[model samples]
Target: MKFIEEVVVEEFLPTFRSMLAGELRERGLTQSEVAELLGISQSAVSKYAHGDVDINDAVADDERVRETVERLADGLETGDMSRVQALVEAEILIRKLERGDLLANLHEAAFPPLSDHEGPLDIHDPEGDLRTTERVLSSVRRGVRTLENTSGFAALIPAVGSNLVEALPDADGIDDVAAIPGRILDIKGQATVPGDPEFGVSEHVASVLLAARAAGSDARAALNVRYDEDVVAKLDAAGYETVEFDAEADVESAIAEALESNPQPDVLYQTGGFGIEPVVYLLGADAGVVVGTVRDLV
Candidate 1:
Protein backbone atom coordinates (compact mmCIF):
# COMPACT_ATOMS: atom_id res chain seq x y z
CA MET A 1 0.00 0.00 0.00
CA LYS A 2 1.88 3.04 -1.27
CA PHE A 3 0.73 6.39 0.05
CA ILE A 4 1.53 9.91 -1.12
CA GLU A 5 3.33 10.69 2.14
CA GLU A 6 5.37 7.59 1.45
CA VAL A 7 6.41 9.21 -1.81
CA VAL A 8 7.53 12.25 0.21
CA VAL A 9 9.52 10.08 2.61
CA GLU A 10 11.03 7.86 -0.05
CA GLU A 11 11.67 10.38 -2.80
CA PHE A 12 11.74 13.96 -1.51
CA LEU A 13 13.41 13.42 1.82
CA PRO A 14 16.64 11.93 0.51
CA THR A 15 17.20 14.71 -1.98
CA PHE A 16 16.35 17.41 0.60
CA ARG A 17 18.63 15.83 3.19
CA SER A 18 21.45 15.54 0.72
CA MET A 19 21.12 19.18 -0.26
CA LEU A 20 20.98 20.34 3.33
CA ALA A 21 23.99 18.20 4.21
CA GLY A 22 25.95 19.53 1.26
CA GLU A 23 25.09 23.09 2.20
CA LEU A 24 26.31 22.54 5.74
CA ARG A 25 29.54 20.94 4.51
CA GLU A 26 30.21 23.87 2.19
CA ARG A 27 29.82 26.13 5.23
CA GLY A 28 32.75 24.22 6.79
CA LEU A 29 30.80 21.83 9.00
CA THR A 30 32.27 18.33 9.47
CA GLN A 31 30.27 15.27 8.44
CA SER A 32 29.57 14.54 12.11
CA GLU A 33 28.56 18.17 12.60
CA VAL A 34 26.26 18.11 9.60
CA ALA A 35 24.74 14.86 10.74
CA GLU A 36 24.12 16.35 14.18
CA LEU A 37 22.66 19.54 12.72
CA LEU A 38 20.40 17.65 10.31
CA GLY A 39 19.43 15.11 12.97
CA ILE A 40 20.71 12.24 10.83
CA SER A 41 23.35 9.55 11.17
CA GLN A 42 26.97 10.21 10.20
CA SER A 43 26.73 7.30 7.74
CA ALA A 44 23.79 8.97 6.00
CA VAL A 45 25.67 12.29 5.94
CA SER A 46 28.70 10.50 4.51
CA LYS A 47 26.52 8.93 1.83
CA TYR A 48 25.16 12.35 0.98
CA ALA A 49 28.70 13.76 0.98
CA HIS A 50 29.83 11.07 -1.47
CA GLY A 51 26.92 11.80 -3.85
CA ASP A 52 25.45 8.36 -3.19
CA VAL A 53 21.99 9.84 -2.77
CA ASP A 54 20.08 10.41 -6.01
CA ILE A 55 18.49 13.85 -6.24
CA ASN A 56 15.29 14.85 -7.94
CA ASP A 57 16.46 17.41 -10.46
CA ALA A 58 13.14 19.18 -10.52
CA VAL A 59 13.18 19.59 -6.74
CA ALA A 60 16.84 20.53 -6.66
CA ASP A 61 16.35 23.09 -9.39
CA ASP A 62 13.44 24.75 -7.59
CA GLU A 63 14.42 28.18 -6.26
CA ARG A 64 12.48 27.54 -3.07
CA VAL A 65 14.52 24.43 -2.35
CA ARG A 66 17.80 26.22 -2.87
CA GLU A 67 16.65 29.17 -0.78
CA THR A 68 15.31 27.00 2.01
CA VAL A 69 18.40 24.81 2.18
CA GLU A 70 20.65 27.84 2.33
CA ARG A 71 18.48 29.50 4.91
CA LEU A 72 18.35 26.41 7.09
CA ALA A 73 22.02 25.67 6.67
CA ASP A 74 22.86 29.19 7.72
CA GLY A 75 20.51 28.87 10.66
CA LEU A 76 22.01 25.54 11.67
CA GLU A 77 25.50 26.97 11.38
CA THR A 78 25.19 30.44 12.96
CA GLY A 79 21.89 29.93 14.84
CA ASP A 80 19.62 32.47 13.20
CA MET A 81 16.39 30.59 12.44
CA SER A 82 15.64 27.79 14.89
CA ARG A 83 15.75 24.16 13.79
CA VAL A 84 12.07 23.80 14.63
CA GLN A 85 11.37 26.85 12.49
CA ALA A 86 13.45 25.37 9.71
CA LEU A 87 11.52 22.13 9.92
CA VAL A 88 8.29 24.09 9.89
CA GLU A 89 9.47 26.10 6.93
CA ALA A 90 10.37 22.98 4.97
CA GLU A 91 7.10 21.33 5.96
CA ILE A 92 5.18 24.38 4.83
CA LEU A 93 6.89 24.31 1.43
CA ILE A 94 6.30 20.58 1.06
CA ARG A 95 2.64 20.97 1.89
CA LYS A 96 2.35 23.89 -0.47
CA LEU A 97 4.15 22.06 -3.32
CA GLU A 98 2.06 18.91 -2.82
CA ARG A 99 -1.23 20.68 -3.27
CA GLY A 100 -1.93 20.54 -7.01
CA ASP A 101 1.72 21.39 -7.53
CA LEU A 102 5.09 19.88 -8.36
CA LEU A 103 5.19 17.20 -5.69
CA ALA A 104 1.63 16.15 -6.50
CA ASN A 105 2.54 15.97 -10.18
CA LEU A 106 5.49 13.76 -9.28
CA HIS A 107 3.27 11.54 -7.15
CA GLU A 108 0.77 11.06 -9.95
CA ALA A 109 3.55 10.30 -12.39
CA ALA A 110 5.03 7.73 -10.04
CA PHE A 111 1.69 5.96 -9.71
CA PRO A 112 -0.28 6.53 -12.84
CA PRO A 113 -3.43 4.97 -11.48
CA LEU A 114 -4.21 8.05 -9.37
CA SER A 115 -3.39 10.53 -12.05
CA ASP A 116 -6.68 12.37 -11.71
CA HIS A 117 -6.13 13.41 -8.11
CA GLU A 118 -4.26 16.43 -6.80
CA GLY A 119 -4.09 17.01 -3.09
CA PRO A 120 -6.25 19.73 -1.59
CA LEU A 121 -4.74 22.82 0.05
CA ASP A 122 -5.26 22.44 3.77
CA ILE A 123 -3.37 21.28 6.88
CA HIS A 124 -2.14 24.69 8.10
CA ASP A 125 -1.83 28.18 6.84
CA PRO A 126 1.05 29.35 8.91
CA GLU A 127 2.11 32.81 7.79
CA GLY A 128 -0.89 33.28 5.49
CA ASP A 129 0.84 34.18 2.24
CA LEU A 130 4.26 32.62 2.83
CA ARG A 131 3.68 29.47 0.78
CA THR A 132 1.83 31.27 -1.98
CA THR A 133 4.53 33.93 -2.14
CA GLU A 134 7.27 31.30 -2.35
CA ARG A 135 5.42 29.44 -5.10
CA VAL A 136 5.08 32.61 -7.18
CA LEU A 137 8.74 33.53 -6.66
CA SER A 138 9.81 30.05 -7.62
CA SER A 139 7.62 30.12 -10.73
CA VAL A 140 9.03 33.48 -11.82
CA ARG A 141 12.59 32.32 -11.17
CA ARG A 142 11.95 29.20 -13.24
CA GLY A 143 10.53 31.26 -16.08
CA VAL A 144 13.37 33.77 -15.87
CA ARG A 145 15.88 30.92 -15.90
CA THR A 146 14.13 29.48 -18.94
CA LEU A 147 14.43 32.81 -20.73
CA GLU A 148 18.07 33.22 -19.65
CA ASN A 149 18.99 29.72 -20.80
CA THR A 150 17.18 29.85 -24.13
CA SER A 151 19.33 30.95 -27.05
CA GLY A 152 18.26 34.23 -28.69
CA PHE A 153 16.07 35.23 -25.74
CA ALA A 154 18.43 38.08 -24.97
CA ALA A 155 17.65 39.61 -28.32
CA LEU A 156 14.02 39.65 -27.30
CA ILE A 157 14.59 42.06 -24.44
CA PRO A 158 12.93 45.36 -25.22
CA ALA A 159 14.69 48.74 -25.08
CA VAL A 160 13.12 49.37 -21.66
CA GLY A 161 14.45 46.02 -20.38
CA SER A 162 12.18 43.01 -19.69
CA ASN A 163 10.44 41.81 -16.58
CA LEU A 164 8.85 38.42 -15.90
CA VAL A 165 5.86 38.51 -13.54
CA GLU A 166 3.25 36.21 -12.00
CA ALA A 167 0.15 37.30 -10.13
CA LEU A 168 -1.12 35.49 -7.09
CA PRO A 169 -4.43 33.64 -7.44
CA ASP A 170 -7.33 36.12 -7.59
CA ALA A 171 -4.79 38.90 -7.40
CA ASP A 172 -6.46 42.29 -7.26
CA GLY A 173 -3.55 44.72 -7.06
CA ILE A 174 0.14 45.18 -7.87
CA ASP A 175 1.10 44.00 -4.39
CA ASP A 176 -0.41 40.61 -5.16
CA VAL A 177 1.99 40.07 -8.04
CA ALA A 178 5.59 38.85 -7.82
CA ALA A 179 8.26 39.88 -10.30
CA ILE A 180 11.96 40.43 -10.79
CA PRO A 181 13.09 43.62 -9.12
CA GLY A 182 14.33 46.46 -11.38
CA ARG A 183 14.31 44.61 -14.73
CA ILE A 184 16.01 41.83 -16.62
CA LEU A 185 18.43 43.60 -18.92
CA ASP A 186 20.22 42.53 -22.07
CA ILE A 187 24.01 42.90 -21.84
CA LYS A 188 26.40 41.71 -24.48
CA GLY A 189 23.88 39.27 -26.01
CA GLN A 190 22.96 37.78 -22.64
CA ALA A 191 19.82 38.21 -20.55
CA THR A 192 21.01 39.46 -17.14
CA VAL A 193 18.69 39.19 -14.13
CA PRO A 194 19.06 42.10 -11.74
CA GLY A 195 17.78 40.48 -8.58
CA ASP A 196 15.61 37.75 -7.08
CA PRO A 197 11.86 37.75 -7.64
CA GLU A 198 9.83 39.82 -5.18
CA PHE A 199 6.30 41.02 -4.76
CA GLY A 200 5.14 44.40 -6.16
CA VAL A 201 8.43 45.26 -7.82
CA SER A 202 6.97 45.49 -11.31
CA GLU A 203 4.51 48.20 -12.28
CA HIS A 204 4.36 47.86 -16.06
CA VAL A 205 4.00 44.12 -16.51
CA ALA A 206 1.94 43.74 -13.35
CA SER A 207 -0.48 46.45 -14.51
CA VAL A 208 -0.86 44.73 -17.88
CA LEU A 209 -1.40 41.35 -16.20
CA LEU A 210 -4.02 42.76 -13.85
CA ALA A 211 -5.69 44.59 -16.73
CA ALA A 212 -5.82 41.39 -18.75
CA ARG A 213 -7.25 39.56 -15.76
CA ALA A 214 -9.84 42.30 -15.22
CA ALA A 215 -10.74 41.91 -18.88
CA GLY A 216 -11.73 38.29 -18.04
CA SER A 217 -8.54 36.49 -19.04
CA ASP A 218 -7.53 33.66 -16.69
CA ALA A 219 -3.80 34.17 -17.19
CA ARG A 220 -1.82 34.55 -13.96
CA ALA A 221 1.61 35.04 -15.51
CA ALA A 222 2.98 37.50 -18.09
CA LEU A 223 6.33 38.26 -19.73
CA ASN A 224 7.31 41.05 -22.10
CA VAL A 225 9.82 41.02 -24.95
CA ARG A 226 10.89 43.30 -27.77
CA TYR A 227 8.18 43.83 -30.38
CA ASP A 228 8.77 42.69 -33.91
CA GLU A 229 6.47 41.99 -36.83
CA ASP A 230 8.31 38.71 -37.43
CA VAL A 231 7.80 37.65 -33.80
CA VAL A 232 4.04 38.31 -34.05
CA ALA A 233 3.93 36.36 -37.31
CA LYS A 234 5.75 33.45 -35.67
CA LEU A 235 3.37 33.44 -32.71
CA ASP A 236 0.40 33.39 -35.07
CA ALA A 237 2.01 30.66 -37.15
CA ALA A 238 2.58 28.67 -33.98
CA GLY A 239 -1.21 28.65 -33.28
CA TYR A 240 -1.20 31.23 -30.47
CA GLU A 241 -3.98 33.78 -30.47
CA THR A 242 -2.55 37.29 -30.88
CA VAL A 243 -4.16 40.65 -30.17
CA GLU A 244 -3.11 44.27 -30.52
CA PHE A 245 -3.73 47.16 -28.13
CA ASP A 246 -3.20 50.90 -28.26
CA ALA A 247 0.03 51.69 -26.46
CA GLU A 248 -0.85 55.28 -25.63
CA ALA A 249 -4.42 54.68 -24.49
CA ASP A 250 -5.55 53.79 -20.99
CA VAL A 251 -3.77 50.46 -20.56
CA GLU A 252 -6.67 48.83 -18.71
CA SER A 253 -9.30 49.83 -21.26
CA ALA A 254 -6.94 49.24 -24.15
CA ILE A 255 -6.33 45.67 -23.01
CA ALA A 256 -9.98 45.14 -22.14
CA GLU A 257 -11.10 46.14 -25.65
CA ALA A 258 -8.28 44.21 -27.31
CA LEU A 259 -9.26 40.94 -25.64
CA GLU A 260 -12.92 41.38 -26.56
CA SER A 261 -12.46 39.80 -29.97
CA ASN A 262 -10.02 37.14 -28.76
CA PRO A 263 -10.77 36.82 -25.05
CA GLN A 264 -8.14 34.24 -24.21
CA PRO A 265 -5.20 35.49 -26.19
CA ASP A 266 -1.82 33.78 -25.88
CA VAL A 267 -0.07 36.98 -26.90
CA LEU A 268 -0.78 40.71 -26.71
CA TYR A 269 1.35 43.40 -28.32
CA GLN A 270 1.52 47.12 -28.74
CA THR A 271 3.28 48.94 -31.56
CA GLY A 272 5.58 51.87 -30.82
CA GLY A 273 4.10 55.24 -30.00
CA PHE A 274 5.79 58.68 -30.00
CA GLY A 275 7.83 57.79 -26.90
CA ILE A 276 6.54 54.40 -25.72
CA GLU A 277 8.70 51.46 -26.81
CA PRO A 278 7.02 48.63 -28.69
CA VAL A 279 6.68 45.32 -26.84
CA VAL A 280 4.90 41.98 -26.78
CA TYR A 281 3.30 40.36 -23.76
CA LEU A 282 2.88 36.61 -23.44
CA LEU A 283 0.28 35.41 -20.95
CA GLY A 284 -0.47 31.91 -19.66
CA ALA A 285 -1.82 29.83 -16.76
CA ASP A 286 1.51 29.99 -14.93
CA ALA A 287 5.06 31.20 -15.31
CA GLY A 288 6.45 27.88 -16.45
CA VAL A 289 3.95 27.37 -19.28
CA VAL A 290 4.31 30.99 -20.35
CA VAL A 291 8.06 30.55 -20.50
CA GLY A 292 7.61 27.27 -22.37
CA THR A 293 5.51 29.05 -24.99
CA VAL A 294 8.27 31.67 -25.30
CA ARG A 295 10.75 28.79 -25.65
CA ASP A 296 8.71 27.50 -28.59
CA LEU A 297 9.30 30.86 -30.30
CA VAL A 298 13.02 30.37 -29.78
Candidate 2:
Protein backbone atom coordinates (compact mmCIF):
# COMPACT_ATOMS: atom_id res chain seq x y z
CA MET A 1 0.00 0.00 0.00
CA LYS A 2 2.98 2.30 -0.17
CA PHE A 3 2.78 5.30 -2.48
CA ILE A 4 5.55 6.31 -4.92
CA GLU A 5 5.60 9.76 -3.29
CA GLU A 6 6.81 8.14 -0.07
CA VAL A 7 9.87 6.83 -1.91
CA VAL A 8 10.56 10.29 -3.29
CA VAL A 9 10.36 12.03 0.09
CA GLU A 10 12.43 9.42 1.96
CA GLU A 11 15.06 8.73 -0.70
CA PHE A 12 15.36 11.32 -3.49
CA LEU A 13 14.94 14.59 -1.57
CA PRO A 14 17.46 13.73 1.15
CA THR A 15 20.11 12.62 -1.33
CA PHE A 16 19.60 15.58 -3.67
CA ARG A 17 19.49 18.17 -0.89
CA SER A 18 22.68 16.78 0.69
CA MET A 19 24.53 16.84 -2.63
CA LEU A 20 23.38 20.37 -3.34
CA ALA A 21 24.52 21.48 0.09
CA GLY A 22 27.95 19.97 -0.47
CA GLU A 23 28.27 21.52 -3.90
CA LEU A 24 27.33 24.96 -2.62
CA ARG A 25 29.87 24.64 0.25
CA GLU A 26 32.62 23.68 -2.19
CA ARG A 27 31.75 26.80 -4.16
CA GLY A 28 32.77 28.87 -1.07
CA LEU A 29 29.33 29.47 0.44
CA THR A 30 29.19 29.44 4.25
CA GLN A 31 26.99 26.87 6.03
CA SER A 32 24.52 29.56 7.12
CA GLU A 33 24.23 30.89 3.58
CA VAL A 34 23.79 27.40 2.15
CA ALA A 35 21.16 26.61 4.76
CA GLU A 36 19.34 29.83 3.96
CA LEU A 37 19.52 29.22 0.20
CA LEU A 38 18.40 25.61 0.50
CA GLY A 39 15.60 26.58 2.91
CA ILE A 40 16.78 24.11 5.53
CA SER A 41 17.76 24.42 9.18
CA GLN A 42 21.41 25.22 9.86
CA SER A 43 21.74 21.97 11.83
CA ALA A 44 20.44 19.96 8.84
CA VAL A 45 23.08 21.63 6.67
CA SER A 46 25.69 20.71 9.30
CA LYS A 47 24.63 17.05 9.14
CA TYR A 48 24.87 17.04 5.34
CA ALA A 49 28.31 18.68 5.53
CA HIS A 50 29.62 16.22 8.12
CA GLY A 51 28.57 13.06 6.18
CA ASP A 52 25.76 12.27 8.61
CA VAL A 53 23.07 11.86 5.93
CA ASP A 54 23.10 8.86 3.63
CA ILE A 55 23.24 9.78 -0.08
CA ASN A 56 21.54 7.55 -2.63
CA ASP A 57 24.46 6.57 -4.85
CA ALA A 58 22.26 6.09 -7.90
CA VAL A 59 20.85 9.64 -7.69
CA ALA A 60 24.13 11.27 -6.69
CA ASP A 61 26.04 9.61 -9.49
CA ASP A 62 23.54 10.34 -12.25
CA GLU A 63 25.02 12.75 -14.78
CA ARG A 64 21.90 14.88 -15.02
CA VAL A 65 21.46 15.26 -11.27
CA ARG A 66 25.14 16.01 -10.82
CA GLU A 67 25.07 18.65 -13.54
CA THR A 68 21.97 20.29 -12.05
CA VAL A 69 23.64 20.52 -8.65
CA GLU A 70 26.79 22.02 -10.17
CA ARG A 71 24.88 24.53 -12.22
CA LEU A 72 22.69 25.68 -9.34
CA ALA A 73 25.65 25.83 -7.01
CA ASP A 74 27.63 28.00 -9.44
CA GLY A 75 24.66 30.27 -10.07
CA LEU A 76 23.96 30.70 -6.39
CA GLU A 77 27.62 31.30 -5.53
CA THR A 78 28.05 33.95 -8.24
CA GLY A 79 24.66 35.66 -7.85
CA ASP A 80 23.63 34.60 -11.34
CA MET A 81 20.45 32.76 -10.28
CA SER A 82 17.93 33.86 -7.73
CA ARG A 83 17.02 31.34 -5.02
CA VAL A 84 13.55 30.93 -6.54
CA GLN A 85 14.95 30.26 -10.01
CA ALA A 86 17.46 27.79 -8.58
CA LEU A 87 14.62 25.98 -6.84
CA VAL A 88 12.53 25.88 -10.04
CA GLU A 89 15.47 24.54 -12.09
CA ALA A 90 16.11 21.80 -9.54
CA GLU A 91 12.42 20.91 -9.41
CA ILE A 92 12.22 20.63 -13.20
CA LEU A 93 15.25 18.34 -13.26
CA ILE A 94 13.72 16.17 -10.56
CA ARG A 95 10.51 15.81 -12.62
CA LYS A 96 12.53 14.94 -15.75
CA LEU A 97 14.41 12.29 -13.83
CA GLU A 98 11.21 10.85 -12.41
CA ARG A 99 9.82 10.10 -15.89
CA GLY A 100 11.24 6.60 -16.52
CA ASP A 101 14.60 7.89 -15.46
CA LEU A 102 16.63 7.35 -12.28
CA LEU A 103 13.84 8.22 -9.84
CA ALA A 104 11.53 5.72 -11.56
CA ASN A 105 14.12 3.01 -11.06
CA LEU A 106 14.24 3.92 -7.40
CA HIS A 107 10.45 3.73 -7.30
CA GLU A 108 10.58 0.20 -8.77
CA ALA A 109 13.05 -0.78 -6.07
CA ALA A 110 10.64 0.44 -3.42
CA PHE A 111 7.53 -1.12 -5.00
CA PRO A 112 8.29 -4.18 -7.06
CA PRO A 113 4.72 -4.53 -8.35
CA LEU A 114 5.17 -1.39 -10.41
CA SER A 115 7.75 -3.21 -12.55
CA ASP A 116 4.93 -5.35 -14.00
CA HIS A 117 3.13 -2.34 -15.47
CA GLU A 118 2.68 -2.24 -19.23
CA GLY A 119 4.94 0.73 -19.83
CA PRO A 120 7.18 3.26 -18.14
CA LEU A 121 5.42 5.20 -15.37
CA ASP A 122 5.27 8.90 -16.14
CA ILE A 123 3.14 9.77 -13.14
CA HIS A 124 5.77 12.15 -11.86
CA ASP A 125 6.27 14.16 -15.01
CA PRO A 126 4.63 17.45 -14.01
CA GLU A 127 4.56 19.06 -17.45
CA GLY A 128 4.35 16.02 -19.72
CA ASP A 129 1.24 15.24 -21.75
CA LEU A 130 1.32 11.66 -20.45
CA ARG A 131 1.10 12.99 -16.93
CA THR A 132 -1.90 15.12 -17.88
CA THR A 133 -3.67 12.06 -19.30
CA GLU A 134 -2.84 10.01 -16.23
CA ARG A 135 -4.29 12.72 -14.03
CA VAL A 136 -7.57 12.62 -15.99
CA LEU A 137 -7.72 8.86 -15.53
CA SER A 138 -7.01 9.21 -11.84
CA SER A 139 -9.79 11.77 -11.47
CA VAL A 140 -12.25 9.37 -13.13
CA ARG A 141 -11.18 6.62 -10.77
CA ARG A 142 -11.82 8.83 -7.79
CA GLY A 143 -15.23 9.79 -9.16
CA VAL A 144 -16.14 6.12 -9.58
CA ARG A 145 -15.03 5.37 -6.06
CA THR A 146 -17.20 8.15 -4.72
CA LEU A 147 -20.22 6.85 -6.58
CA GLU A 148 -19.65 3.27 -5.49
CA ASN A 149 -19.62 4.34 -1.86
CA THR A 150 -22.70 6.52 -2.07
CA SER A 151 -25.75 4.69 -0.71
CA GLY A 152 -28.16 5.20 -3.64
CA PHE A 153 -25.88 5.92 -6.56
CA ALA A 154 -26.87 2.67 -8.21
CA ALA A 155 -30.44 4.01 -8.43
CA LEU A 156 -29.15 6.70 -10.77
CA ILE A 157 -27.81 4.22 -13.33
CA PRO A 158 -29.68 4.13 -16.62
CA ALA A 159 -30.93 0.88 -18.18
CA VAL A 160 -28.21 1.27 -20.77
CA GLY A 161 -25.73 1.67 -17.91
CA SER A 162 -23.49 4.68 -17.22
CA ASN A 163 -19.88 5.62 -17.75
CA LEU A 164 -17.64 8.40 -16.55
CA VAL A 165 -15.17 9.64 -19.11
CA GLU A 166 -12.36 12.18 -19.45
CA ALA A 167 -10.49 13.28 -22.53
CA LEU A 168 -6.81 13.97 -22.99
CA PRO A 169 -5.95 17.66 -23.22
CA ASP A 170 -5.58 17.37 -27.00
CA ALA A 171 -7.95 14.49 -27.66
CA ASP A 172 -8.66 13.76 -31.34
CA GLY A 173 -11.03 10.80 -31.00
CA ILE A 174 -12.43 8.11 -28.74
CA ASP A 175 -8.99 6.50 -28.43
CA ASP A 176 -7.79 9.49 -26.45
CA VAL A 177 -10.53 9.19 -23.82
CA ALA A 178 -10.21 7.08 -20.67
CA ALA A 179 -13.31 5.19 -19.54
CA ILE A 180 -14.47 1.91 -18.02
CA PRO A 181 -14.14 -1.03 -20.42
CA GLY A 182 -17.74 -1.95 -19.64
CA ARG A 183 -20.40 0.46 -18.48
CA ILE A 184 -21.24 0.83 -14.80
CA LEU A 185 -24.48 -0.89 -13.84
CA ASP A 186 -26.71 -1.45 -10.83
CA ILE A 187 -26.48 -5.09 -9.86
CA LYS A 188 -28.21 -6.39 -6.73
CA GLY A 189 -28.50 -2.85 -5.32
CA GLN A 190 -24.82 -2.05 -5.73
CA ALA A 191 -22.99 0.08 -8.28
CA THR A 192 -20.49 -2.17 -9.99
CA VAL A 193 -17.47 -1.42 -12.14
CA PRO A 194 -16.92 -4.47 -14.32
CA GLY A 195 -13.29 -3.82 -15.27
CA ASP A 196 -10.39 -1.46 -15.21
CA PRO A 197 -10.60 1.79 -17.13
CA GLU A 198 -8.95 1.95 -20.54
CA PHE A 199 -8.73 4.28 -23.52
CA GLY A 200 -11.38 3.95 -26.27
CA VAL A 201 -13.66 1.73 -24.19
CA SER A 202 -16.65 4.03 -24.44
CA GLU A 203 -18.45 5.20 -27.58
CA HIS A 204 -21.46 7.27 -26.49
CA VAL A 205 -19.99 9.37 -23.68
CA ALA A 206 -16.71 9.77 -25.52
CA SER A 207 -18.44 11.15 -28.59
CA VAL A 208 -20.42 13.57 -26.46
CA LEU A 209 -17.22 14.78 -24.76
CA LEU A 210 -15.42 15.14 -28.09
CA ALA A 211 -18.38 17.07 -29.47
CA ALA A 212 -18.44 19.31 -26.42
CA ARG A 213 -14.75 20.03 -26.86
CA ALA A 214 -15.16 20.67 -30.56
CA ALA A 215 -18.05 23.04 -29.77
CA GLY A 216 -15.63 25.11 -27.64
CA SER A 217 -16.56 23.92 -24.17
CA ASP A 218 -13.63 23.97 -21.77
CA ALA A 219 -14.97 20.92 -19.94
CA ARG A 220 -12.66 17.90 -20.13
CA ALA A 221 -14.73 15.41 -18.12
CA ALA A 222 -18.33 14.14 -18.28
CA LEU A 223 -20.61 11.56 -16.61
CA ASN A 224 -23.91 10.10 -17.85
CA VAL A 225 -26.83 9.20 -15.57
CA ARG A 226 -30.52 8.39 -16.00
CA TYR A 227 -32.44 11.56 -16.82
CA ASP A 228 -35.34 13.04 -14.88
CA GLU A 229 -37.16 16.35 -15.36
CA ASP A 230 -36.94 17.05 -11.62
CA VAL A 231 -33.22 16.46 -11.68
CA VAL A 232 -32.79 18.79 -14.63
CA ALA A 233 -34.83 21.47 -12.83
CA LYS A 234 -32.71 20.99 -9.69
CA LEU A 235 -29.50 21.37 -11.66
CA ASP A 236 -30.84 24.46 -13.36
CA ALA A 237 -31.99 26.01 -10.06
CA ALA A 238 -28.60 25.31 -8.57
CA GLY A 239 -27.01 27.48 -11.28
CA TYR A 240 -25.71 24.71 -13.55
CA GLU A 241 -26.17 25.73 -17.17
CA THR A 242 -28.48 23.23 -18.88
CA VAL A 243 -29.07 22.40 -22.54
CA GLU A 244 -31.36 19.95 -24.36
CA PHE A 245 -30.75 17.96 -27.52
CA ASP A 246 -32.93 15.62 -29.58
CA ALA A 247 -32.32 11.98 -28.68
CA GLU A 248 -33.76 10.82 -32.01
CA ALA A 249 -31.18 12.76 -34.00
CA ASP A 250 -27.48 12.05 -34.46
CA VAL A 251 -25.80 12.42 -31.06
CA GLU A 252 -22.89 14.51 -32.33
CA SER A 253 -25.11 16.86 -34.28
CA ALA A 254 -27.55 17.19 -31.40
CA ILE A 255 -24.78 18.13 -29.01
CA ALA A 256 -23.30 20.53 -31.52
CA GLU A 257 -26.62 22.26 -31.98
CA ALA A 258 -27.24 22.51 -28.24
CA LEU A 259 -23.78 23.93 -27.62
CA GLU A 260 -24.07 26.22 -30.58
CA SER A 261 -26.82 27.98 -28.62
CA ASN A 262 -25.13 27.68 -25.19
CA PRO A 263 -21.37 27.48 -25.59
CA GLN A 264 -20.59 26.37 -22.03
CA PRO A 265 -23.23 24.17 -20.45
CA ASP A 266 -22.65 22.23 -17.26
CA VAL A 267 -25.50 19.83 -17.99
CA LEU A 268 -26.79 18.24 -21.23
CA TYR A 269 -29.95 16.13 -21.34
CA GLN A 270 -32.10 14.39 -23.89
CA THR A 271 -35.81 13.44 -23.82
CA GLY A 272 -36.38 9.76 -24.36
CA GLY A 273 -37.41 8.62 -27.82
CA PHE A 274 -39.04 5.29 -28.67
CA GLY A 275 -36.63 2.51 -27.65
CA ILE A 276 -34.09 5.10 -26.52
CA GLU A 277 -33.31 5.83 -22.91
CA PRO A 278 -33.13 9.41 -21.72
CA VAL A 279 -29.82 10.50 -20.13
CA VAL A 280 -28.36 13.53 -18.40
CA TYR A 281 -24.66 14.30 -18.55
CA LEU A 282 -22.79 16.29 -15.92
CA LEU A 283 -19.84 18.16 -17.33
CA GLY A 284 -16.94 19.99 -15.69
CA ALA A 285 -13.25 20.79 -15.81
CA ASP A 286 -12.29 17.31 -14.53
CA ALA A 287 -13.84 14.05 -13.39
CA GLY A 288 -13.70 15.06 -9.76
CA VAL A 289 -15.79 18.18 -10.39
CA VAL A 290 -18.23 16.24 -12.55
CA VAL A 291 -18.62 13.66 -9.82
CA GLY A 292 -19.07 16.37 -7.24
CA THR A 293 -21.94 17.74 -9.28
CA VAL A 294 -23.52 14.29 -9.34
CA ARG A 295 -23.03 14.08 -5.59
CA ASP A 296 -24.97 17.32 -5.25
CA LEU A 297 -27.88 15.62 -6.99
CA VAL A 298 -27.72 12.78 -4.49
Q: What is the C-alpha RMSD of each candidate to the true structure, in Å?
A: 15.9, 7.2
lDDT string for model 1 (228-283, tens) is 99999999999999999999999999999998987889999999799999999999
Off by over 4 Å in 2: 1-124
User: What residue pairs are clashing in model 2?
Assistant: none
Please identify model 1 stretches exceeding 4 Å from their true place: 1-123, 126-128
Model 2: per-residue Cα lDDT over 110-155, one tens digit each: 8886664445777655866656666777888888898899887888
Query: Could you tell me how far off, in angstroms, the CA of residue 4 lies in candidate 1 after the best superposition?
Result: 22
Highest-scoring model, TM-score: 2
Candidate 2 positional error at 136, Å? 1.8
TM-score of each: 0.59, 0.62
